[model samples]
Target: MSSFAGVSVLDDGMLCPSTMTFVSTSSDCGYHLLVVKGYARTKETPNGQSILSHDFGVGGYRWSIKYYPNGIISDRADVVSLYVHRLDDDDGKHVEAKFSFSFVDEVEWQNPVYIRGMKTCSFSSDASSWGFYKFMKIDALERLMNLDKDDCFTIRCDIMVCNAENDAGGTQVLLPDIHRNLNNLLHNKVGADVTFEVGSDIFSAHRCVLAAQSKVFMAQLFGPMKEGSASLDVIQIKDMEATTFKALLSFIYTDSFPDMKEDEMSQATEEEAVKYEMWRQWLQNLLVAADRYDVQRLKYICEKELCKNMCVSSVASMLVLAEQHHCHRLKEACLKFIQVQSPSCLQTIIASKGWQHIIATYPSVLNELIAKVIASNQQLVLK
Candidate 1:
């Protein structure tokens, strides 16, 4: 035993905010006009004289307002009176709601900082209306809402209908669909601030979204050189093809490759075989473009597709691509293909001379691969 007894210690008794748990509420705002066709009838109307607004719905309930011209009571005649009437079922069921009314001028401000009295009201069959007797002074209302000059003024009512309380598990919500919305934005070009010119093809995009996705784009669009392309003029991209850039944009907006139905070479005829070979070349060009733009995912995708389409003729070029684009796995795959071939088989492949393009472009890479082939053959003889 310790010498401490069952004594409670308070760490400097204090009050602070705790996690919030409360009932949810659904709310909507509806605007209705309080206009005067002429100054005469507006002022001449007797006290308690009211005009009704067309019905508007809020939170599944129909509501309309009763606007009293000279106030509902005699003593309050100098002010305008407004009452919101519920036109829903008159059954014993009651609705617990709170609402606020403000002039249109206040609601349309940069920051609507209007205030209203507190307290939620219960509306039942017997009590179906709630209101303010002194909604506003007639003279002040006219000045704020431009009633005297505009010939009409509007009032806004914001209603909050309380929802049922959630259990401890809380409420389930819908999944966020950011990709679909971003794709829509790309097609719509509603707030596009930048335009790209690839050869003769023009494309518009938002700079912020591009910056968020690619550091290369961020540097060109917002970094030190941004001053040159600051205006609406098109920024030229000379090296990339229009099709490749289009696919890049699709990935940027949707984080996915545009759906492509790749031809399977093993099952394809001679015509499809030609298309399959063309696809392999496209992947090479696309990989180079992705690397230039620093789009790592697209670059990796290109590398993987090239590896899947690799053949004896593509060995030399694939080896060069592997080194140039940081494709270590692809390099290993290419080396493995070389290591499994017999010395005579390699001679026949070299005789075919299908790798001449890579040999002309990257002679050293082919030479190194040839050396690896000789080393693997010598080891096979020793085995």
Candidate 2:
């Protein structure tokens, strides 16, 4: 016989003569209670060693219990054998369960023998059942049978099925053409509702699209303190380039940057160089505009591009821009390039014309640079 520790017996309506209840508390667990009757006088054929109970349903599957009164194995001759069998064809399906086989006492009607544990069983054409060959001692079963009223006993199997197929059923919807449609709308300006005049250049765009993408646009266009001419058809923007504003509108509509040739600078003539320089300046202005308008993704893309183009001459200017616009990654990259990439890069940056402007404008940035230098020296001394 097996011994149990820390097992609690239920004395309420749990051990009734004809009824028992099993409940699964887990949201993903399913419950089933199987009851077996007739303890001592279970019918056995002359040559058969075990008897099968009536089949029960649990989680859309049929199951049955097989009991051996004597013993199924030679080594476990002194104990009774018990097994749970899957009656239906699982067809490669797997079932998990926590079950208990109990022998209810008739005299007390409360105390019972319980054999319970969590188990995982897989179904195959070869074998479809799992259990213990030595379930309980034959002497213990006989003593329990003697205490019963009409040579009857009851056993309960509590099953919790997990990972069942088709448990959650629904159709999923997907949109594959959304990006292309939005990009076309942005580039074509098919249904333009607003026009922005920047210097001598004018661009047509949708106000709703801008308002949806940016809180600053929303406030300027629809909030309580909106500008007087914002309700008009044309709104003029000052201190921003037409090209930079166009790029910002493209990002708002398409949620991505417009594609550009990577080798434009490498193959540039004098005219192409001027055009590339204008585009680079536009990107810097767009970065400042993105931060002012609270467009974080645009700011992130600008920071990444600036970090990629970092040179000794541009590092100081990039640091000033990072400090002014609160771009932490770009600021850290500029410092790292100055300190680690080349020691001479620092002197070169300090000698730049923007270095005096940086000290006059951002004293905190100078403090941070000094702190990094001190920390680096301390690490070198310790090593």
Candidate 3:
């Protein structure tokens, strides 16, 4: 009988589905909580002594959570006891139900460590209280109090009373897709107060969004070194291409990249290869732009993609790019690729078109490569 709670802004400001994050039960299900004040003092009560909780209502029946700070049994004296008490008279009507007893922290993320009552247990005249004799160890309870200065603790009970009418099916509720809002903002150009001129193409973007995602944008758009403080002016980007910038904006808004049709590599058409190379170059440029902007996640995505595309033909040039961009992981990968055989594989890589550029521009990288080769031989010798 429960309905969708719609979307809600979390404490961290991200929009999320209320059903999963806010509520975990239907209308038929209900909750009961027991807050024991001066919880540490309860240890003096000794074994077999218990403290009954205040009454709570669920499924038209009066119920109370039972707590034993110093356990209800002799052998289990070191642990606390907990139970659900059926308070109403044993009417034999609507007495079947399921319940969970869980200890939660202040920030109530779902704890997997909870005791769920057997599904549909009958609350008959034979039993008024049914629960765990040893719910939580006293040491665990002490650790809970150490998290905060408070002398209090709480145990929650979630109850779902069974019904014949509810046996048909559960209600269908749609979860909130939060990214759709950002997608709409991006494509619809709502509140986009900044423009970028990249070569022949112009893009509309939000300054705040960009600043939040990239440190370069933060400095240039809102802080010192601002380029286009006046919203009417276009910020000139001399280096990045339009396609690369577009993909970058996509990632900033939706945290997802535009789909690159990499599967088309099998087709091997002139047009397809051209298209693929066009995107490949864009991806490479995207990494450089990401690095410049100080967008770590985007830079990581670019690095991972480049690594997946790495081959003998491109590893040498990739090594040079990695060194220039300060991409340590990519440099390591390329070094490993060439470290196979210095005379054969290394020479083959050295004969590639990019090696001449590397020799002329980055002589230090050549030294590092030789050092890596020596280290590899040393490791082999040691083994």
Candidate 4:
């Protein structure tokens, strides 16, 4: 039960006498009363103001005031309260109560304590009362206050949608393309251990990788998850040398690669073209690692380089290699390159001991090569 006093109401042309009080019967704030004063607003404000102002409850509430024929005004009967009243029919028969009273005052506060390091703040419609809601932690308090603040500061409260911006910390989360569908994954392990910290402090809690088949190099930016398991799209890197792996890890922690200069790419005796080839091989190893980790951009770099060094000899070997590793796209690309450059190229390579191994492994492919070779030689016969 709850109760309050100092409420006032007004009556007709003449001031009436009536008083009402608040009484809480149930678990919640129940009813209120108003004490009516005989006269309401008669002439106007004592200062001869055009419009009269009543300072009571804040905005979003009803105001009840009444005026009598005589110059006298009743402040009691003019009171209005939102609390409901439940009186028996026999208790009162339209008692001509003219005035009523109800008092409403806003409680002001200085600076509220701010709660720092809040990871999340949530709310429910029927979970708590207004008083309880007002006294939540500063993070929650801030969330509620955000309701009154500018749109920019308001913490979006949708349960399904996460905040669009990254956290203030170094955490970078790559979200799935189907953000709506993947919302449920937040509760999963793949979601929990995800976090990012720049120097020492964590800036973000999750950085999601969207594409399942894209190549990624987590070691290049923000070291590996260290504790959780992850999936990758492709695996190009075979066994990285101990030093190379360390270099890659360092790059991940700090966005800087080691001093891999052009001069260092080859020995002095090797041809300049061979030097480029060495660099290309080194890059291919890096691409393998990147592709295995689902880093799409890195995979593209590897493909670009391979295309630049395109040749009939390498295409057949690349096709066999790509197929062996289940690199469907890469295999198709290499096969297409062979078909376009020289259709008989694979048959010629197959006769060599080095490539005969592949032809034996794929006898059906050998038949396809023989047909292509015969077709190519048909032009020679016509000449």
Residue 263 lDDT, candidate 4, scale 0-100:
35
Q: What digit string (tens of lDDT, one per residue) describes model 2 on residues 248-363?
A: 88778766564444335524489776666655666678899899888887888788677766778878888999998999989998887777755677788889977878889888
Q: Which residue runs does candidate 3 get wrong by more than 4 Å?
A: 1-177, 227-232, 266-276, 341-345
Best by lDDT: 3
Give candidate 4 misplaced runs (Cα > 4 Å).
1-238, 242-270, 336-348, 351-354, 367-383
- Write candidate 4's Cα lDDT for 1-383 as tens digits: 12222233433322233423322222111123332222223222222112111111211111222211211213222211121111221322221111111222112221111211111111122211001101122232235435234211211000111122223423232222243233334324254334433233322223334223222434523346422435322222335644444333333332233344533443445676577665656655665655566544445445544544545545655555555545565655655566555437757655555366566676665566566758878977998
For each candidate in turn, give its C-alpha RMSD to the true structure in angstroms.
28.8, 24.8, 18.3, 29.5
Q: Across residues 1-383, which tens digit of lDDT does each residue of candidate 1 receive?
A: 01111111111121112211211122333333333344434556689876665555665566666777688876668778878777774644566556666654444532323333223566767889888776667875676667667545445555655431134434322223366578888999999998899999999999888888888888888887676655635788898888888888887886665544452432358987787787787778888877877888778777766765688777767777787777887887787776677888667556554456556776776677779879888998999
Across residues 236-299, which tens digit of lDDT does each residue of candidate 3 receive? 8887778888888887887665667554542467988777666666778889888988888778
- Residue 117 of candidate 1: its Cα lDDT? 26
TM-score-sorted candidate list, best first: 3, 2, 1, 4
Best by TM-score: 3
Ranking by lDDT: 3, 1, 2, 4
Candidate 4, after superposition: displacement of residue 226 in Å? 9.2
Model 1 TM-score, 2 decimals: 0.49
Better of 3 and 4 by lDDT: 3
The CA lDDT of each predicted structure is: 0.64, 0.62, 0.67, 0.35
- In candidate 3, clashing pairs total 0
TM-score of each: 0.49, 0.51, 0.53, 0.30
Better of 1 and 2 by lDDT: 1
Off by over 4 Å in 2: 1-176, 227-231, 266-279, 341-344
